[model samples]
Target: MRIGELARRSGVSERSLRYYETQGLLQSERTSGGHRHYAESAVDRVIRIQTLYAAGLNSKKIAKLLPCMRDADGRPNEIATPTLVNELTTERDRIDRMITDLLRSRDVLDEVIDTAADGATTDPASLARRR
Candidate 1:
């Protein structure tokens, strides 16, 4: 497909697709007339790239991880280095901590709601004192 079709199918912008190509996260071929063509798998590739970006991995890190990903052919590909795995694990842990903290905050807000529903006018100073 053409770049525009790829972008539409992948839900990624055209500029991002071109940037991914430049970053070696994606590949494309040029036609005789110099128009860029992408394989059907490019849509999946773009989704994977976006996932990695959302996971806090930079393009350079993703480039390394890409070699570890394999096609349906079951061919062995390069594995992620221990260092990269460690970094990813640490980031996951941090995200987990943030989630836990947010949940605790939500619980506290729930308590405030209960108190308010009970006709308790929560004194700001009392809340600060509790904190």
Candidate 2:
């Protein structure tokens, strides 16, 4: 498919698709007129790239990690080494800490919300449900 098709199918903007190409997180071939073309698998690849980025992995880290993902044959890729494993482990731990912090923050926000609701809300049933 073409770049536009890929972008539409993947729900990504054309600019981001180009950026992903520049960052080496995506691949495309060039036509004789210099238009970009991608294989059908590029759709899945772009989604995978977006997922890794959403997980807080930088382009560099994602580039390394992408190849370590499972192959089409359902087997783990051989691209991961012990060093990469250690690095990914550290990243996972950092994400875990961030999750914990966010949960704590949400708890605090919930308490403030409950306190504010206690005064403004007259529906005891609704407030009880909230708590």
Q: Report, for every candidate in turn, its global Cα lDDT versus the true structure.
A: 0.86, 0.90
Models, CA RMSD each? 5.9, 4.7
Candidate 1 residue-pair clash tally: 0
Q: Please, what are the lDDT tens digits per residue for candidate 1 over residues 1-131? A: 99999999999999999999999999999999998999988887899889989877789988988888875466647777899789778878987888899999999999988987664345776667667
What pairs collide in candidate 1? none
Model 2 lDDT at residue 78: 64
lDDT of 2 at 68: 89
What TM-score would candidate 2 get against the native? Answer: 0.87
Writing each residue's lDDT as its tens digit, candidate 2 over 1-131 gives: 89999999999999999999899888899999999999998888899889888878899998889888986567877679898899899999999999999999999999999987776588787779878
lDDT of 2 at 103: 100
Estimate the TM-score for candidate 1.
0.75
